[model samples]
Target: MFLFIRSLLKSPLAVGALVPSSPQLSRLIASQVCCGNSHVLEVGAGTGSITEALLNLGLPANRLFVIERDPSLVAHLYKRFPNIQVRCGDAEHAAAILCEEGISEVQTLISSLPISNLNGDNRIAILEGMMNALAVDGQLIQFTYTANCPFPAKRLGLHAERVGRVWMNIPPAVVWKFTRASYAL
Candidate 1:
């Protein structure tokens, strides 16, 4: 109850995205990438909307590492998803965080970040961070309201493929799956 308000204030953008992820979209994301018992790094975990979906899809809380920059939202997340390791920091520094956690690479990276809001440098940094931290065959799934890829996927040596779209979501969003150019298992 109280947490919802806090989430709203701290994450007006995220709040606008839809607090509870749609079942169909969640299932689509889970089916496209998430495999049982794999390490996943979730960025911009605002209000834990996607976090809820991830957990509901059977990814254990302990196996997931969430990174959020807002303190108030981070507090709210801690209260809601107590078992998750909530890092109150930027996702651009995910490489350092993953190393600190003794995680060599993550099998999947899920993001609810409003990449379209970020400038070129920051966007590139976040994308590069995720790419470098991802394991072989790892996948990055991100959602955006725009139909096109949020980042210059091809310029960055990433292959972007639209997995699905959720018109039921606020403003209607498209899910993009990013794989490294030379991705090999």
Candidate 2:
């Protein structure tokens, strides 16, 4: 908890929320996860609360990869989930980061990034990369404190749907799922 608070205080923009993701919100996000071997990329894995939930929900550790911008948080994640692949990079460079690792595509993306804190360009790049890297039937799950959709999926030519609302979280959050605009499944 001290680590989370210190990181949050050091970088408000990167951390976004004042607290780490609650187990309730994490489980809510995991409930939408599709069971498969395709890689699951988690953006902004702050202290890895959601990562734990993902693993508990049956996602294999080898198939799970996470990117955390803060070096401190990255170290913490590494210590927490030693078997999981954890990267230290910004969400905007997620595509390139995965490409460097020879992973061209992923099946699911679970993000806890504070898109509301990002500027338009950065946010778009992050969202666009996530959309492009996703498999055709892939789902991008994001939880936001606001009631509205944070990602401009419609503007980005993707379909967005509200999958769940986690009222148990401290600030309360809604999960939004996104897929390609033409994807029917």
Candidate 3:
């Protein structure tokens, strides 16, 4: 908790939430990952709450990769999940980070980023980078505190679905899943 609060105080925009993700929200986000051997990537892993949930769901540490912009949070994640690959970087460079880690694509990309708060260019860059790192049939699972879709899914030629909502969270959150439009049917 101290780590989260400290990180939040240090960078409100990057940390985004007053508290780390609630267990309900974490599980809900982790549930989006399909049962498979394919790789998984998580961005904005603040204190690794969702990352813990993902591991609890049986995702191998070796196959799970995480990117956190805050150096402190990145260090925390490294100490918390030493086996998992945790990088300190921006989500806009997720594709490059994955490539450096020798991951061409992931089956699921989970983001805890504050997408709605970012400006147009940053939002597009981050989302596009995420999409690029995802497999053709992969899914991007994101949560927001708003009722609306976090990103302009249709405008970006992506199919979006409101998967679930976790009202038990601090400010409550809605989960949305996005996939390439052509893959939707």
Highest TM-score against the true fold, candidate: 3
The per-model lDDT (C-alpha) reads: 0.78, 0.86, 0.90
Model 1 TM-score, 2 decimals: 0.86
Least well predicted 10-residue stretch by lDDT in candidate 3: 29-38
Please report how far candidate 2 places residue 123 from its true position, in Å.
Answer: 1.8
Instruction: Give per-residue CA lDDT, model 1, range 80-146, as digits (tens).
Output: 8999888888788887888888878888998878787778898798888877778868889988878
How does residue 69 of candidate 1 score in lDDT?
A: 82
For candidate 3, write residues 67-108 as lDDT tens digits.
Answer: 999898898999999999999998888989999978888989
User: Per-residue error at 82 for model 2, in Å?
Assistant: 0.6
The model with the greater lDDT, 2 or 3, is 3
- Best candidate per lDDT, number? 3
> For residue 104, what is the lDDT in candidate 1?
80
Give candidate 3's whole-model lDDT. 0.90
Candidate 2, residue 55: lDDT: 91
Q: What digit string (tens of lDDT, one per residue) describes model 2 on residues 68-101?
A: 8999899999999999999999777777888899
**What's the TM-score of each model vs. the native?**
0.86, 0.95, 0.97
